[model samples]
Target chain A: MNYPNGKKGSLTQPSQSRPSGAGNHAFSNRGMTLEEDINETNRFYLDTDKAIIHKKPTPVQIVKVNYPKRSAAVITEAYFKQASTTDYNGVYRSKHIDFEAKETKNKTLFPLANIHNHQVAHMRSVVEHGGICFLLIRFTLYQETYFLPAEKLFQHWDDKLKGGRKSISYDQICQEGHQIPFQYQARIDYLAIIDKLYF
Target chain B: MNYPNGKKGSLTQPSQSRPSGAGNHAFSNRGMTLEEDINETNRFYLDTDKAIIHKKPTPVQIVKVNYPKRSAAVITEAYFKQASTTDYNGVYRSKHIDFEAKETKNKTLFPLANIHNHQVAHMRSVVEHGGICFLLIRFTLYQETYFLPAEKLFQHWDDKLKGGRKSISYDQICQEGHQIPFQYQARIDYLAIIDKLYF
Candidate 1:
């Protein structure tokens, strides 16, 4: 869990977190992190047939396979593949949905670099085609998650390229984003924002 | 490439013909066959700045790694993680483009079983939200590809569940799908249809 030479536990630290269940060790205090909570919420959504959202699977490339005696073939060599789309996407109330989820511990700001250029591009397309695209930013320090529309994020991202701030300030996020509440069942309560914005 | 199942020019065949640049061995074509072609098309899209689509990375649960003589660490033990989203996605003309690319040698129809329930559910969301969602089905035997929208595909899928035909006939596909031309550059010129339909 020790990251070398950088201020650890900042807003973007979760990027260093293991992408799957194993990453839980990094956030021992929180028990289940924001992803797990949202996953549970998504499951509830599916079970109830209210809305269908899912976190995309991680991509891998298998290089070698081993066929042991009288057993199923085993994959021996594989490498990770770059993802082309956002992490989460699905349907809600007959609408197409697409988005990415990010968590940061920094109390004051969220780094724009945490998002890849392609993801920004993907979100832009989602919005253009009439899909609701946004980022679920979790300020772990404040235990707060905000749904920031992609349009706003993209403007700030382009501005940064033209000598603006590297990150979006917490104040701006507070002003623009819908603050998502935490619940035991639907931990992120993102659907509340979705309902308000799209419905 | 001849498969043991009497199929010709199959990507799944270890003895299939390969283009010049790829590695020259049986080990190279070990993973999903269509994945590389789609990725190359995506790369072309990005390089040309035509669209910003990408295939999601594979999800792996890395259980163990071996450091052998300062080379790339060899992954010794791992398990595949289930995917929550479709394979390919991006933006075209400021719209969200998301889809799964599947190839079947069979010329008659596409099997609903090849696609998972979860993926269908995810596509449903894209349609609901107004995103251009579809399935790129390649009839390898016919050297033809079709872009079937989520709505059209889902209808047949629903009928299948109700004890209808297990597959969609090529005649039905011709009626429902928009033909995608295979250019040497883009490979599949799907956006043209998108332009005609959505624009």
Candidate 2:
């Protein structure tokens, strides 16, 4: 299928050496982190009146603060706390959208260790309460990002608890998950998958 | 109307002396801050499978970190960042829920300075996107908490920008907002108001 940005060739040939052209601009984004791309895409969605989503700030446990006479208070000692919920959440078309994003350089499989048990429980509760939840898994090696519904993730998660495979193979993900098209503005374009699966 | 948890008398008689009875236990919670009360209420909501809401972590800008050998990375230089969105957001009854909570010791008015311009803008966008948005205002002196819809807040917020009153009068809030009933488990029972207004 034709990708949204019409740069299908570049997506498939992620590592190919090509002459500097219009597509080179999109290739510059390759160095950007998944979080950066999603943040940019969320901004585009907000500016276009398509969605209201945001990444929650990193959880930090502040221990000490120093107040200078003529400056803002500075945190002197703090530690990072594990997030209990997913990274991104918001409203789209009157529905609550909740999801966590992860990029794996592994070409063979996506490790289950990347996700925490509490987050899986939280996602289950969100689904039970009638909210839309999913995971954005990006295979960095192939430049492929897949939108995996939370329900599909739960199956793999539950299997691991019962001594099944600790990771999901690349072939399994491609079969079970929807591939998110690359777009110039909306780099991740996961919402496009949402529109098809939900709306 | 009779309030939930059968503590209506305690809610109205904030300063009245009462015999140390079963109700006194509930009154002990008076010393808790609005944030503490809301956190407890949210925990109750989660435990009962009533809703899925969480307070976003405080936004912090980390500038320096020290990686001590065999120890967690310690943040050495960080500063608080202004939050662009509301504090609490999640889903309830198949609808997106978003809100900010504040407590005012002022008996007459809730100062508009307590809320930032960008936060007001964020609330407006949430409403436009079909989310259930509101404000949880607590009058500490009166021991009363009110759920103010974003629509009513916008009226006063816009008026303030146009050189009107810089604060919302307590009386006006009582007229335009729904008083959340004080409960034992759900300290600030805001969801009860949501059920009436949105469900």
- Interface RMSD (Å), each candidate? 4.2, 0.6
| Per-residue lDDT over A113-134 for candidate 1, one digit per residue giving the tens place of the 0 to 100 score | 7899878877776676567789
For model 1, residues B1-199, the per-residue Cα lDDT tens digits are: 1123323333444444332234454544532345555776677876776776767666667766677786766676676666666877666775667899887766587887888887887787677655679988877655466889889989988998899988888888889998775455555667778888888
Give the top-scoring candidate (TM-score).
Answer: 2
What is candidate 2's CAPRI-style docking category based on DockQ?
medium
Write down the C-alpha DockQ for each prediction: 0.24, 0.78
Native contacts retained by candidate 1: 0.34
Off by over 4 Å in 2: A1-4, A8-30, B1-5, B8-30
Q: Which consecutive 10 residues in model 2 chain A have the weakest lDDT in total?
A: A14-23
Give TM-score values for chain A, per-prediction: 0.82, 0.88
- Model 2: TM-score for chain B: 0.87
Clashing pairs in 2: none
